[model samples]
Target chain A: MINKTINQKAWFMVLPVLALVAFNAIIPLMTVVNYSVQETFGDNLFFWEGLKWFEEVMRSERFHDALGRQLLFTLLILLIEVPLGVGIALTMPRQGIGVTICLVLMALPLLIPWNVVGAMWNIFALPDIGLLGKMLNGVGFDYNFTQNTFWAWATVVAMDVWHWTSLVVLLCYAGLRSIPDAYYQASKIDGATSWQVFRYIQLPKMKRVLTIALLLRLMDSFMIYTEPFVLTGGGPGNSTTFLSIDLVKVALGQFDLGPAAAMSIIYFLVVLLLCWVLYTLMMRNETN
Target chain B: MSSITLKSLRHSYLQNPQSEEDYALRKIDLTWRDGGAFALLGPSGCGKTTLLNLISGLLKPSEGQILFDDSDVTSLPPDQRNIAQVFQFPVVYDTMTVYDNLAFPLRNRKLPEAELDERVQRVAKMLSMQNQLKHRASGLTAADKQKISLGRGLVRSDVNVMMFDEPLTVIDPHLKWELRSQLMRLHQQVGFTMIYVTHDQTEALTFADEVVVMYEGQIVQIGTPEELFLKPRHTFVGHFIGSPGMNILPCDWNDGGAVFAGHQISLNGNLSNPASTSKLQLGIRPEFIRLASEGIPARIQRVDDVGRYRIIKAEVGGTSLNIYANEEVEIPSDSLHLDFDPDHTHVYCDGWIHEAKGQS
Candidate 1:
């Protein structure tokens, strides 16, 4: 073994990155922590609340309803988008000019700004003038979304699928493209049906990308606010109000900052915990 | 098992091919008997793999038909062709166990579970993979993965032809020789028609009974290993099949003999009505030329000692020539000469060997 010199100044190189992260994430997070444990009025006067807000937010029936609605929305979109995305990607052409055309078409929806997507669908699903709404009502169904809770939920879900399914399609397409041609040739020579080829060859190869698509859609659909807020404004009663929309109604709309801050922290923790659990589950299967 | 035949087969990747250069595989008409081990030997971009794919029905020929023992199969898909192809890379199913990977082809045909298990077990045993049958295929080594791919073909009972497209390319060098011999042994035991495509001369010459040498999308020659060495039908075969290749010398046809560097050299056969307009050259393997006391005079330029023999590079009238001499042979310092073995030397018109009269 050779004698090696250790430098004490090497740690200085990491200071800038730490400082940048502290300002961007850690400092803002600490303000939320500060608000969660205390109460404040318009004058910035504070009083120790001692976990009272956490208790209130945890026990609130409104919070439970919002959480349930968020979970259901995430589950619904994930069920619809992931399979639909994978199906579209599977049917896309694998080569030639058609590949370029299909890829560009898939990427079109993802290129729109999130708020623009929300605003565009808000008008696009209008009952009287919009093509989709007029056609639905014209086909002999009473499909007005402004006052109906079911139609409101349906419109929001459809808008989210239309705006976000393209992302999953592109991700799964990249994964599908990475597979070697030999696998397909071998499967063909093995006399596998199309379903068997998908089950044995395509699915296993797309697992990594599908995991990414799931996590992204799960988190995005959970924190969904812009599209549904613009489309239904949490509906005529509160049926469409998800966790973020509920938290916003409390924090900004109703000015209940203490409970709202606590709710925000809880929401962040839920997303983090859910993503961690899902990533661990997926990676565990991969290693085995 | 069936004898394969290709009748005027041609293929082009372009939708509208106007010239011969547009064809990836030029017109080919050939046949192979059942249970014959043949190798398509060529350098890269020589359409060996294209020919293999056309035979296996992965690609349909742009023109003409492919026959498996006199039945046209040009329009059939690869699955319906009843063929198996091991690719250049290992194509095992990663999520499957070794046993499942082998059983896949048989199970797809809905063979009874009892027969499927028996066939899988037989193939696993033959590949020496019986102990790893329960192991996941992705967890195995590269060579083991390749063996699993090969085992997949072996488990199928109805496969008429087993094609290999340079299956040893991804294998380690030490494992390559072992896998090659195992393939030869497997071919002998099963006695199926095997067509191996490769660019490596040693692999092709050793694995195949009759090596089909190809160049620029055309089959140059098809002959046994000894025949290729002794009598290469094309100049490309003479250059491609041997180590350090055969030596070619530009010559002129003078009085029915090849005149090379002011020396009249006799050929293996009699020349009849040679084309005066076509270019002519003399071809001889380095092994067939030796240092002589009385022949075409040459000056020794350099000597490469290849352990067993020394390749003597000499200059004759401004042209370079290579001769092989044994390690113990003495080299004359002054006035060195070289002699060509008439039985092995041949004259070529253009790129092809001239089919002179009185030859076998």
Candidate 2:
């Protein structure tokens, strides 16, 4: 018989982390809960408003519209980024100086601060004087992004794609490179076509990393705020207002603290639930 | 069925290989006849895999040409060479089922449905994987996965040759015999040219009709298993083949007399000696060393009883030698006269066998 001694000393190693979480996550979360079920105007005056903010936020058309736009944006980019990232990664060189150059170029947009990225695009796409705006106007198209709803949405989506597709490319490239040379050799001996090799070998090997890329892109896109907020200020007729932007507007602009807290909680729960579903679906067939 | 011929084939990974050491595979001009079972037996860095890859067209030779039955396939790729190569590790599509894995090659070529099914079922049944046909390939054990790899190679009956690079390296010891016998039976049934590479002597001896022993990127000897044991052309073969290996003793040749430990030993025939100052050694298997009434004196060092026989480790003039004796024989304690069978003992000059006069 084997004997395992009971050791209570290991709990000391995790106490700091527990204290940190209590200070950081749990306390702030409790504050949000307190504000969600109560109302306060000033001077510590509070009134009990049980679930009123939650009910109002759920019924509001503005919240639904923001969620719909967020979903559309996420869906459109995912549909574009995944395959496009994979295609670009496949075409990327496996080795040499060109790899460093390509990676640096792709990472340039990601390295820029969110505000700077928004400002850069704003000035680049301004109707009167910006380079892209002047070029589009010179090309004889009405391409004023601040006034046109279609152009505003297009510019925001395009900016996000430009900013984040490199992440997908790098992840998928790592996944593609992880496959052993033996598989390619055996496939060659088996007379496998190039497409067959991609389908049966490369794609299955990349599935894990691609899943990670999808989850990251989905969560980040769902909660996007800084770039589009700076670019169009969720304007051009609220066309680019996503969930986080709407939450910020309600919290800071209107000072609707109770409704904002309720909306924030719901937004967090939606991201958690959607991410859980995506993870569960992706990992279902992994077990033996 | 095809007869593969390698004409002055050499390979080097370097861009400008100037010397013999730069070449991964030395000048290898050899022929593997149709439907022959051959094994490239060597150690880890002996260039056997390089030769196998060259034959399969996975690697093109840096110089010379490779011909498959008079067709120069020097620059052809592995796909067009019509050969199947089983890698050291099993390579199967992880997402596909066992049946689909077997059917992959046939489907790639757009074979008819009934024919593809028949081939897949036939190969699966050959590998005893019929029950696992629907299971995912990734869920199988290492041995079964390797069997699926072999099945994939064999399912395509049109492949002119099949190459195995250490196929049984991952198999359990007890199951290796089973799989080897299965492979032998399959070879007899299929009758396609097969080239197997391994560092294990037992695997090479058991699976191949002709074992091509390689050392340092060169072919040392190519012969049947019996010939490899009886008359190893190089000292490397003699040392690498037998269990507990052959005993190689440094000796001297003075006026055509083979002298060991200040005593003269007579062999079966005369040696075509190299330079008198050059090095020479007496190579003999432990089985041929016998207890004699009067021979070279040696002291008994240790004796190990390994079930059927006893391995007597002894020292003679600062050199250690192993002798495999029957369990019934009495072991000498202090000193013993060790005799070498004249018919089996031979002289090696600078590692190569010095062929006796008028003997092939």
TM-score of each: 0.96, 0.94
Write model 1 residue lDDT over B1-360, tens digit each, in one string: 788999999999999999999999888999999999999999999999999999988888899899999789999999988898999989989899988999998888999999899888889889998899999998998899989888888898878899999999989999999999998999999999999999999998898999999899899898999999988888899888777788888998888788999999977666774699988878999899878888999998888888998888888888887888898899887569888999889888897888776665
Model 2, residue pairs in steric clash: none
Per-residue C-alpha lDDT of model 1 across residues A1-288, encoded as one tens digit per residue? 999999989999999999999999999999889989999888989888979999999999999999999999999999999999999999989988999999888888888887888788878878899888888999998998888988988888898899999999999999999999999999999998999889989999999999999999998998999888888889868999999999999999998888999999999999999999999999999999
**Candidate 2, lDDT over the whole model:** 0.90
Encode model 2's per-residue lDDT on A1-288: one tens digit a residue: 889998999999999999999999999999999999899788888899999999999999999999899999999888888888999999998888999998888778779998888999999999899998899989999998898989998899888898889889999999988988889999998888889899999999999999999999999988888899889999888988899998988999999889999999999999999999999988995774
Q: Give the top-scoring candidate (DockQ).
A: 1
For candidate 2, write residues B1-360 as lDDT tens digits.
799898998999889999999998998889999999999999999999999988888888899999999999999998888888888888999999999999998888789999999989998888988999999999888889999999988889788898999988888888888989999999999998999999999999989999999999899999999999999999999999998888899999877778998989888876666687768998999999998778889999999999999999999999999998998888878799999998999788899888877887
Clashes of 1: 0
